[model samples]
Target: MDKNTIEILFSERKKVGLNLFEIMKEQGYTKISFSNRVKISRPTLNHLFEGEISSITTFEKYLDRIRDVLQVQEQEFLIGRRTAIGELQVAFSCNEPKGYHPGEREKEMFEILEDLINLCDFYY
Candidate 1:
């Protein structure tokens, strides 16, 4: 692939990352938890957001499986009240790094959110 084409692919991959973020947020998934769910490391997910593939071998092992995992996980997550909660504006606004792991408390918040979602799903 030419340099331009490679850059385009990287750009497209970033878009995918953003789309994945939206899906995750709707389902109350922080980056750390999503990485766990996807069975990929947090750094791998960050590299994906940065649109730079660090290891071809790693990609070969896991990249193709992401979609399949997402399908199954999405179904599980969608059992709760799912909707466009809001947008963070990170993609356009943040000038620094794009992906960051949630802190311990933040992760706890996500866990609480997940419990609430489960309750919502169970009740309705």
Candidate 2:
């Protein structure tokens, strides 16, 4: 989309880390443990979370597996829902920007983030 929408999207994407951290704690999983259990290498998981987009193709495989494990469809979890996590009542997922076509790098990263958000919702 336009520059303002892109900026907003990027801003929202960063907040998923807290959601993820909460989810991991709720599920009793460390990064290493989660990676191993999910059959995704630690570095790949790191890359996905850190927005490192060099391995986009490889990321899709891991994303699919993550989605399967989370039992969430790719397009089904981005809506704003109220999920209680301790005292935090954050939106269950980020608001996706409409009519936006992300670049190769961002496309991969967004997909990963979206699936992970869904995974977080599933876990919590």
Candidate 3:
């Protein structure tokens, strides 16, 4: 894609990151807890969430991690939250970051999210 296309996509991704923030808040997920659930460093998670990540690979990697953590489909996390805008965006914001590992229950949640994504793709 051209520079303009890439920029637009990146901007959209940032919006998705913002939406993910709302989801995390609703689910009672703090940066420290989320980083632990995703098994990523706090700084990297913060960079990803804030859209300050310069590397596309890093951005996508953390996005995938977040999708896993939230037990949401990738497309749902990125673009489908428009269906419930008001409920999803209720007074949500965060900046703090800290780290740890994804435990078995968290891994199960990720697997469920992945399965839902695949099921949606298969049916739709």
Q: Note the Cα lDDT for every prediction shown.
A: 0.55, 0.54, 0.63
Better of 1 and 3 by TM-score: 3
lDDT of 2: 0.54
Q: Tell me the lDDT of candidate 1.
A: 0.55
Model 3: per-residue Cα lDDT over 30-121, one tens digit each:
77777788898777766665667777655666666676667876555455343444532222223325565667887787777778776643
Pick by TM-score: which candidate is best? Answer: 3
The reply for model 3, stretches above 4 Å from the true place, is: 1-11, 79-124
Q: Highest lDDT among the candidates is held by which one?
A: 3
Q: Regarding TM-score, does 2 or 3 come out ahead?
A: 3
Per-residue alpha-carbon lDDT of model 2 for 9-121, expressed as tens digits?
A: 34543243344433544557777777877797776666555545344345455655665665544333233332554444335444569987667887787788778876765
What TM-score, to 2 decimals, does candidate 3 have? 0.51
Q: Model 3, residue 124: displacement in angstroms?
A: 36
- True-vs-predicted CA distance for residue 31, candidate 1, Å: 1.1
- TM-scores of the models, in the given order? 0.44, 0.41, 0.51
lDDT of 1 by residue, 1-124 (tens): 3455334434466464555555656567777777888888877777765556755445434544565665643223223332565442221121335687667887787677778776643332
